[model samples]
Target: MPHCLYLKHLDIVPGDRANPCKGLMKPITIVYSSKKGYPLVHPCTKCGHLSRNKVAMDCTQED
Candidate 1:
């Protein structure tokens, strides 16, 4: 998933791309939660915006 579609940026906020920081988000780590299951933590390569998204059912830890 694209971070611009999910991450909360500076003033632009989440689920929006109105901001000028069109940075590519890279997955940094994965965390397991009892409620949310496994979510991957991603941070923008340009502006450093961070976001966590639930991994797809078919996705593996190596991804």
Candidate 2:
């Protein structure tokens, strides 16, 4: 029910485009990790495939 993004390709394995699930990745929650920082948890609406990805970092902005 949350906001989702319609990606042209799925990156479940990070750059792996062979995945057949072309579902919209819905952002469900924000997860915190000591090593990975605050990465977002996105699950596919169609296949329910989930992935954790780091937020885009701005070069001019401090992390």
Candidate 3:
């Protein structure tokens, strides 16, 4: 089954734009399926932006 997830923390404070003082925050999309071998990837859903760095955009593990 293909599961679709919508990111909670996207675009710095849940908006399309970002704050200059806070910096730009982006959305991260993760896919986990045995058929695809849990391909860990991040693609901005808020604005269709792509980033090569996964760790930088990880908001779930943040303190």
Which candidate leads the pack in lDDT? 2
At residue 2, give the lDDT of candidate 3: 42
Task: Tell me each candidate's TM-score.
Answer: 0.60, 0.70, 0.25
Per-model root-mean-square deviation over C-alphas? 6.8, 6.2, 9.8
Name the top TM-score candidate: 2
TM-score-wise, the better of 1 and 3 is 1
TM-score of 2: 0.70
Model 2 lDDT-worst window of ten: 1-10
Error of 2 at 25 (Å): 0.5
Candidate 3: tens digits of C-alpha lDDT, residues 23-51: 23243445556555444454554444443
The candidate with the higher TM-score, 1 or 2, is: 2
lDDT of 1 by residue, 1-63 (tens): 422323434346655667787767677788999999989898888888778877667543421
When sorted by TM-score, best at the front, the candidate numbers are 2, 1, 3
Of the two candidates 1 and 3, the one with more favorable lDDT, higher being better, is 1
